[model samples]
Target: MKILVIRRDNIGDLVLTTPLFRALRQRFPEARIDAFVNSYNAPVLAGHPDVDQVHEYTKGKHRKGFSPGWLERLGQMWRLRKEHYDHVVIATPGVHPRQIRFARFLNPAHITAFVPPGWKMFGVDQPVEYLGKDRHHLLMTYRILLPFGIEGDPPAPRIAFTPPAHSPGEAPVIAIHVSARKPSSRWPEERYAELMRALHERHGARFRLFWAPGAENDARHPGDDGRAARILASAAGLPVEAVATNELEGLIAGIAACDAIVCSDGGAMHLAAAMGKPVVCFFGESEAHLWHPWDVPHRLLQPESHDVADVTVDEALAAFDALRQEANAA
Candidate 1:
């Protein structure tokens, strides 16, 4: 049997779909599993052991509504028509009519999608209701893949990549991803710097400070802050280094090799959690119950409001200290 899992969204969305990949692989060890992912987030699944192929779907590249874009869509659809898939799973949360049409275009044996109760549709059966009251988004999506006999615990999504070549005896490190793709989710830089200072003072030679790829450009706080760099210098005990490449896969491998990570509620924290590393993550304004890292000794500091800066520096430090204790115990 062959399967194609389609999730076309941002990094976090792609990350959430990884457990489905693993589940399918476990159930059909010999079957080929392909992931249809957005081009920007393709690297997250590049080296995943459970995935046999990575199919790129460029957003807006083939989207034309009866205009000049129609031809491009025709070409892309023609390419998709060539692949014979035994099953096609649409894992993206938001329902798009075009996705159903695309699945039909694949001419698969069957397609499974989520449709809320009272939702009526044509040519689609077995509507899977949104799993209510289950907060974690990744876990919720994993359930949709269950009917195909891909059962059991959906392990947290993980990425596998080669760590960048490091100089000999590089110090133990704590990666800090201080930015979020959404501006409203960022924690204050002053607080982050203070936590770095505390970690440096406490751990001394054991801890190095590092910034994640794309953080410098992901979200910008007003005043053109150099807080991430400053914190690494004064609070981090060792000179900072960039990953060999800015690719998300390389970033995950680098984080996996770290002693721990301190980050806001973003893709990096999810990666760390999936790697089973100790993580201290801040959450504010976003839904913590839904997006928080899973099954790891993680500390979540949430703000009362949407502004992540509202989560005080001391609160985050307390979580960090707790995570350290947990890591030591483990």
Candidate 2:
């Protein structure tokens, strides 16, 4: 069978859908599994053992209200028609009437999608209200697609990427992601520095810092921490390398390279968790139970009160210390 899965969203959302890819391949060993994803996340599917093809869409640019150009949409429709897919599944939310209309235009044997609380899943779900909570969106989406006759289990979010592997002989490593795009999401840099200091005292030179590439522009621009590089330099006390270049594949590889990750609650944290890498994620303005790493040796540090900043360096350090102990025990 030929199958097409659409998950044109962010890096984190794409990572969450990989488990579904694996499950689909396992069930239909002879099937072709293709994904339509945002351009930024297209690379994440690189070297995935299960996927046969990947199509990229420029939705981020299209969202700014520029002409996506009718020809581009026409080209996609033509490609889908030519591929002759037997099944099509849209894992992304906000499935428009037009999207469903187009899928029906192709005459796929099955089409599955998820609709929010008040919305209807016209062809499937028989138009049930989606009352599930947040973060469970990934699971809910997978469940919705299953009834369309796609054979697969609810997959634990796992990403596949080939990185320069480490020898088992190396000392235990600690991975850290010290920056985030949004200020409200970023933990104070000094807090990171202090945590690094504490970690160095405990692990010495064994720790490594992995940074999201392209973040340098955010750090170097005049308004964005003109001295951010130097600040991170002083704080981390170790050379930070750009492992993930704002692409899904690189992000997955970078996370896979690490034994554990200390990150703010963002795409990287989600990627790390999906890889089954132990994670210590700091949170703000989000619930830990909803977003924290699942089924992993993990800890979530969210603010006690209304202010997310209330989670101090001390609390974060304490969490790190606990992770370290777990590592040693393992």
Candidate 3:
């Protein structure tokens, strides 16, 4: 049997779908398992062991980089139509009519997707009931796999990257990601710097600061260049290195190297979880229970105001300290 897992979503959504890849490989060990991912999140599956191949295409919005403008994606879809996949799993939660229509265009023999309870999808050969938004997103995503008789306790999403070996006696390296798309999720720059100093003084920890690389005013991909700059200046005389990453791969590699990570709720937090690093994540207006780092010893520093800026530096430090204890005990 041949299978294709379609997860053309954001970086974190694709990361969470990784467990589906592993489950597919285990259930059908001899079957070929491929992925349909966009260029933005393709790097997450770059070297995954269970994934046989990745069909990558560029999305239209990020047109500055490559040929994902329009005609190219159509041509890519034409190629997929020729592959004749036995099963195509649309790895997304809830109803996505656009993606469902695209799945029909692929002309796969079978499609597994989540449909609304009373709605009918035209080409969905196997439909999983989307009860409601109650469980973690990963658990909701796993519903797409029930047709294959694989159920219960999906494995932690697997990332096929290794951290560079470090000396046991060296101070632990904590990664800080200052980029968050939502204003509610962003912690103040001075607070991040102060938290860094506190962590260093308390645990002798070095820091690697990671952020999206672009001007803050860039409307296409508004980055935290100014925030990163201010934080670095505020936390001078400390061992903090700003990791410049123009792509998702660079961010993933930087996170893989860290002993732990501090970031607001976004792709970086999910990447940290995939890397198996302890996390002290800030959850603001987003759904805290639905999106917390999965199967990891971590703390979510979400204040009553639902703004990360309201979470104090001392609160962040204490959260990380508690996480460290939990991680060590585990």
lDDT values, one for every candidate: 0.70, 0.67, 0.89
Q: What is the TM-score (0 to 1) of candidate 1?
A: 0.83
- Residue 285, model 1, lDDT: 69
lDDT of 2 by residue, 230-299 (tens): 4466665453553433444555666677678888877888877776777888777665655567667888
In terms of lDDT, the poorest run of 10 residues in model 3 is: 60-69
Candidate 3's residue-wise lDDT over 1-330, tens digit each?
889899998998998999999998999999999999989999999899999999988777776765446788789889998899999898889788898888889899999998888777899989998987788988989878999999999999778778858987788999999888888998887888898999899899999999878898988878878888988999999999999999888888888989999999998898889888899998889998789999888999899999888998888989999998897788
TM-score of each: 0.83, 0.82, 0.97
TM-score of 3: 0.97
Candidate 1 residue lDDT tens string, 1-330: 878888887777788788888778877899988888776788888779999988875567433354565566578667766777778888876555778778888887777777666785554554566657465788778877756866567877777754435466554477777666566677766666676666666664234344444334434323222545665555444435434434566666677667678877877787777777788877766788888888788887776676776777677777877877777787
Once fitted onto the true fold, the runs of candidate 2 whose alpha carbons sit more than 4 angstroms away are 60-69, 93-98, 116-129, 148-153, 163-169, 205-228, 236-249, 306-308
Kindly report which residue pairs in candidate 2 clash with one another: 43-249, 44-248, 44-249
Which scores higher on TM-score, 1 or 3?
3
